[model samples]
Target: MSQSDELAAQDAGDSGDGPIEELAELQVKEEARLEKLFAEQREERGLDDETTLHTFFKLFDMWIQLYRLNKCMEVLPEVVPICRSRGGDFHVKGVQALAFTLWKKSQFNDAVKLFHEIEDLIGCSAALCENMGHTYSSMGNFDKASEYFKRALQCLDKEEELGKKTGDRAGILLGLGLIEDRLGRFEQALASVRESQALFRQRANGKPSSLVAKAGMSIAKILLKLALQEPDDDKRQEMEDEAIIREEENVALFEVTCGEDSPLTASALRGLGEAQKRRGRVPEAIASFARSYQIEAQKDAFDLLGIMEVHNHLFGAHMDLVKLGNPLNRASFRNYLPTVDLALDRVRSMKQDANAGAYYKVAGEFAAFAEEYQRASKLLSEAVCLFKTEDDSKVEGLISHCEELKDFCDAQLSAVRGSATANVSESKS
Candidate 1:
């Protein structure tokens, strides 16, 4: 309705492109007007009162719900100082918002510093400590992250005694589970994840749809990881069976709460596929993978990285069937070739990791099976480079296997070279 805003809109309408700048300008004006209104209201109502403090907290929470990170970031810097100036219950949330913004921005060190400073000023809170835990975890400071997460759990327990919400306790457990899993502490990860799953189930209060499903998925994932590390066949099968049961629960819950087409259902299906594969139900595993891939393709097919993962799973399923001498249509995986190539190209552009090496090796092996020896040799060479970055004893077997496979591929090419040379020599003579 403002003159400048109307003019900007009119100019944007004249062009075919949408009015990004005009929309942003209008947003800024709206924010300014709201700020002025809130200031006026604060003047009449008094900022020191509980009601006004409640209003700011709600405002910040609304910003979070809307995912207005830039706006939230802008307001947080000013809001924290104002809260510190007056000092109230709002400071707790102000610190949370500021620290969360810093964490989201990937300014991990600054976020940690700000959280500690806020703790010194207004004392530590569960949410603030949780933010620091997440921040340090993301920054790869696992020890510090573990320390803060445990502290968060303790504070949350004390807060629960005051009749506050304990939903955050489940979140802390989930975080601990993830960290433990990454650290290769499978038992600890299972304990934490299982505890979180139990907590979520207990708190289900008629509408635990997402909460229960999430916790179940976490447990299922941990079980799968444990199964991967287990050398005993029977124990691994048992682990996989447990994981399948968990994933089936998640899938059923998602089917009721969401739909069959939901991404949660797709995720559950993918996990189910892996579990079934490990449990020696290859046919069921292949079916589950195909279903998962179909759902993912329909919903988010253009998500390159995600598609690559799905393709990898699908390819593995097919390869597993092939190994068992089952009649599987190998042509079904031909479509994945281009996607694998794309993933290889993209991964090559980034810093090498074990995951990158695995992808490369699998793609190379797939190519070799298809008798695309030149492509296989090229991809396998890239895989060799990435694998060299890993020195963990666990990966030595994988590295050796890769070298052996690469040599096989080279020999096949060499035989082709010899045959071609013989033909050329005969023709020249």
Candidate 2:
């Protein structure tokens, strides 16, 4: 037999083992060798001599890959003390990684401590400050987040004057935009996002980068916010139309650069759903949100998926059982009520969190459903209270609606008691 035929016959005899498996085994061996090299370098540098810092870092990275964020956090403290003791360029990098890992694991206090430590060691890099701001923002301390984001911008500006590349500056601008958006500074957010978009477009030589995807997503978010604020019917329609166009473009860019499975793609899909909802395309909006929710769920992005569902309902994709049409339509609507109720229940649970306002707004959405209105009103009133404390003008309408509902409920209770008294008097007569 020829050599190829002989190997094929032997493979067939061995139950069809193939070259792909051999390649995978070779890759694993190569990775092991590379990891060994990293460990040797760490030991020679005397950083965690007994246990390699590189190995710990690699293990933490692997934990993140496996979606074991809590485990990653548990390993981080072990590496951090060694990095702090042995001060070097890699030490700063280690601090940054640890801070980010803590932030991802929702250990905000630890993240802040590490960020402060990094700032002291590195003398304030924009990247460190921006990440600290992100950690604060995730913790719902928007004011503190905005302060750090501004500091990051200042650092980036100084670096730019010293002839640094534009990449860091662009990143700072994007960070500022996100912080501003969260704080409801829509105009400032737009300006920051646009600046970042311009910078990314200038940097793109031909192919798309992750930066481009980020910029597109930021601009889309700004546009969506603007659309929401527009009060004039024609103006709002125009804004929604523009937002839809931007969303489609962003989705295309995200798919091309990061593929459909990435968080950016999921965000773009959610934005598209929002725009479609604004345009009164309920079915299309629901479909887009459903896909976005599926992708986010697969990535364990539960909070983000919940936010998307809230918007889906807020945009008037009927979640209640009430129908304005025939019996079949009523049945179809009824079929969706269970899902709607589940979403509302999840939102209600989230409202018990420190940041209750976000969930309350979502719960308030089901207020039109008579069966759910009382709960919705209570949630809406709580949201209004939070927003009122923040000096948000948008809460006025919600507060008024909540008061009206409360009054209506009181009146109904009084009428029921009066009727009971009348029945008792008639029975005595």
Best candidate per TM-score, number? 2
lDDT of 1 by residue, 139-223 (tens): 7788987998888888888989998742277667766876787798989988987887687677665542444676687788888
Clashing pairs in 1: none
Which residue pairs does candidate 2 place in steric collision? none
lDDT of each: 0.66, 0.58
Candidate 2 stretches with Cα past 4 Å from truth are 1-78, 105-107, 140-143, 165-167, 255-259, 301-316, 319-429
Which tens-of-lDDT digit does each residue in 161-192 have in candidate 2?
89873225666677677777777888898898
- TM-score of each model, paired residue for residue: 0.53, 0.58
Return model 2's CA RMSD, one decimal. Answer: 13.6
Clashes of 2: 0
* Candidate 1 lDDT score at position 427: 100
lDDT of 2: 0.58
Candidate 2, residue 374: how far the Cα is off, in Å: 26
